[model samples]
Target: MFRSFPAMAFRTRCPVLDPAAFCFRPSTDLRNPETVISEPQAKVTLFEAAELLRNDEVVAIPTETVYGLAANAFSPAAITKIYATKNRPQDNPLIVHVSSLAMLEEILPDHRIPPIYLPVINRFWPGPLTIILPKSDRIPAIACNQPTVAVRFPSHPIARALITQCGFPLAAPSANSSGKPSPTIASHVISDLDTKIPLVLDGGQCYFGIESTVLDALRSPPAILRPGGVTFEALKEVLGMEELQVYKKHFVDVQLEMTPTTPGMKYRHYSPEAQVVLFEKPIPLGNGLVPTIDNTNCKGFELSTMVAMTILETDIESLRSSIAHEVEQLLSAGNRKFGILRTSSSSLQDITKNRGSTFKSSTEFTVVEKFLGSALHPEQVAHELFKCLREMDAQGMDVILVEGISEDREGLAVMNRLRKAASRIVTM
Candidate 1:
């Protein structure tokens, strides 16, 4: 069952009195990896979460997109624990979550927002959009490795209540081990962070199963450094942003090494434990998955495909054939099990049918398949993408194959993440 902050608090902001006035609840101590906080779970009330933050202890809080490991952005000691707990690099900055514009104003250098972002903020604030702004001195250097910082105002009631109650900005990143899929539920947090943090306020599953869009309006003709819940089409609708550029395949900033303004920039993130292969084109709708065994027309591949094919056999007939051949090779090499993340347009059952009688007779074939909702409904696919990836990982599959979707609407963000997670990408 899903849960959130109180109805009264959800409707209106309520100022929480000083946490020092309340008796601090004892937090479960976890000294070993084997230690688990079961039953009543490790969920805490808004008041308790506020006290934990006041004590400079890290707690996992749910957001509209994913759970965040939150700490007082003003405290250097508290921020350091977040890095250590997630094994996150010190140089990769964290996003600051604010409850209201007033909280956002308190942290800005001039207590003013840039004029360019006013329209976007007006349209997308308190949602899944994060904006990059100049860092104020009040923000510790440890929280931002660069001169700028990323800020987000989450819409989740539990998240807003906890931040409002704490009366300070929280420096938070996805509450999972660095380089893994971000957590979308309390249990996902516990599975990865387990007693690493003091508490997890279990609001429920996230609305968008991906992270917030990291937009840098500070740049002329703003560019999307990282794609997330906010779509490119949505941002383009805002005035003065029609020429907006995406940092995905369309363009790459050579300056990223010297200036990474957002979290996903300059990092390999959202990867599962298994070796991942992504088929960039949708599996042809009507034909079976495998290509003709007759190897032909293998030249003139796309850049990613060309690079990937250098590793694959020269005789493969088509993209689908390459998939079957790769699976066979892995099976031949004694990797007996695999996993597949299918979109509505593609299916593992198709592959089984393609293999014909050989598929039934093959003793080495084992695959776990999961569907990520309809391709026509990218929103549903976006809402389930990360959680489904984590689910496949838990199944102990040796390798995971993902089907790609068109970069339209939310599919743009989906493809961006898929590119980052894939060890091999074939865009035939």
Candidate 2:
């Protein structure tokens, strides 16, 4: 049946799976008629997966956040390989992905489960949400550049199988090459880091092509460290919806540089090569009314190479049409060139199936459809922001304006990222 990648041999005595044994190129096959891998054989091999992981080597594993190149959290050599392969800054520590509550207890300081977090963990575990807690003495300082380390229980079976097999938390970063795009398929993994890493258990595609939501349990009422699958609204509902108190409750120290005890806390993260400019959704005053341009600072769009991003399926065209129609009416208005990265639900589904991998645990999401709807969800968008930005950026646009998503379910995840990607934030 589905066994933790059964090893052909033992770890200590087992010879490395001849790195050549793997195809440098991944199989082009996508869409497993059956969305879920109910068949035992359809799952990933775990023992071999562990052997590779233990050796301080990289293993491309799937997570709700994105496809990640993971390593033994405790091993310094393994951590270094992740940096070298992804070209990620060493100062930016990595998140530790675990399979169960037992594993978390084994690794994290066995602190009292604050009553406040109980409901949250019960609701969102084995998914994309991450809990940052006090570091266990046994943990490697490298896991968290700060005093607290970020940990998660991935819902993907293959991912859980691999992590449980490894017997240690795996420190994983998005598998794609550094600063490029986060990989969602076997090909994306291969394109970015095939030879550099050992084995990648092709587990179809990822549902949430983003990072996990990182919440700080260290705070009273709880605060979000990094946004991901779980939304702030979700957090508020579970934890007594009170206005997040600043100054006092939100006492988190932002991690930067390889500071002894935190990870993934530092760095201008989730950015694509293209410079993202945030714009106001509705026309603002002064530069207010028509023109569809925010006059407060038209300087960001002064250059003609800027592209205002919006979903092709969205009614955004009404405003766009209005802007083009009124451009002549508005004096001193500038020539704003647009490069659109529009994709319809069906077309996006096709592209996700053809290009990105499907999530093994769920079928509700696809690669392209993730950007649909409104409301900003930073975590989900963060997962694919780099990829989307990279695509538009490649076209040679000067400034990239990402259309805002409704801050609903996946939309919540999109907004956080849009806020960061857009130079200026706007609402439609």
Candidate 3:
């Protein structure tokens, strides 16, 4: 019943889907399902995008979290194009996107949603939460051969409309090159995947600006494989998720990484071309009363007084000194340009003023600073993290210094991505 669209023919026949022609109201709420498209041209564009998917062509569609490179989940041929286009690792599995619970039922092995996920589904469906379930015969093994497949019900109207129009579950991953930062806006997808895929349904900027919170409810205690838009606190509030565990740096699983059941597990993900250096929050001493600097690689700089101050007090100055020290070291290695992703509300003027007082005039390196929202509001940080990384990378920075945030709520997911992206971690 399903026909495969030849990659060459699909590319030649279908012109790039223009974002100007296709626009939708930006909303993440699942209950309110009114009109999504603003212009009539968007309807025609949506149909053309759906047609490409029906014919097994990979189409870039926007999700509430990020844009996804989608293809028919049932067709191995279609899924193959997704892998080739993105150069994604074969071992890393793709998450299937569904429009409704009925579509989700069609992909399960027994045509029944897993009992463990019923409560979670009720609360977080049509959101940024992804659940892994047993795969049916219809879903190709290339999608996920490990007996289970990761699936999501995206709240983005264009993504939902496209999936519903195609009349099938779509296996879609973040519409960017493998291991690179995920695309939050349609332009990010077009920039990374230009000429690689046929159509990218431009649904404007994604609300979450990250990936979905992937949960494997099949496991005991139900661990979150990858944290994203959904916070652990939110999921823990769910009826059966009181004991939800997150697979993070402290909780390392070798077997899971070797054969990841979900995406963002086994690979070096959320990275930019420039080297990322993450400055983590200081950890408390063994007594949990006093804070201690775990590591600060600033040689020849005095940090005794800075270390004595409480964790909260050691904010901007400490970070500036550490970054200046790092830049000085890199300067010896002949590196010129540097970028800093600030977590605080500090402005570029503040950084510039401090640079004059901090670094020697003789040090001839350029430092560009961009704020990633305040630490008080972690949601703003999450939304701006990847975009800042890409922007800094585009500016030809040799190194990027990211000031880490407290691991609470959305900060947990933010730190998770930073940990994976960072080549070096500094505790301050």
Local distance difference test, per candidate? Answer: 0.74, 0.54, 0.77
Please give the ranking of all candidate structures by TM-score, highest first, separated by commas: 3, 1, 2
Error of 3 at 397 (Å): 1.5
Off by over 4 Å in 3: 1-38, 283-321, 345-351
| Deviating ranges (above 4 Å) for candidate 1 | 1-44, 282-317, 357-363
The regions of model 2 sitting more than 4 angstroms off are 1-44, 240-265, 274-278, 282-338, 342-387, 390-400, 406-409, 422-428
Candidate 3 per-residue lDDT, tens place, 1-428, comes to 22344445334223334344423333433332333555677678788888888887888887889889999988888888888888887888999988777788877878888788888888888889999888778887754568888999987767887787788889999999988888987778877888778887777778888789999889888899999888999999997888899996437788888888999988889999998887664533332233222324221122344443444345446766676676567678787788888854432234456666766646677789888876667788889888889999889999887767667778888988899899888776
What TM-score number comes out for model 1? 0.80
lDDT: worst 10-residue window of model 2: 24-33
Best by TM-score: 3
If ranked by lDDT, best first, what sequence of candidates would result? 3, 1, 2
Model 1's number of clashes is 0
Tens-digit lDDT track of model 2 for 178-274: 6555666566676566556667766655777766777765666556656567767777777543543221125545422335233334445555555
Give the TM-score of each candidate.
0.80, 0.64, 0.85
Q: Is candidate 1 or candidate 2 better by TM-score?
A: 1
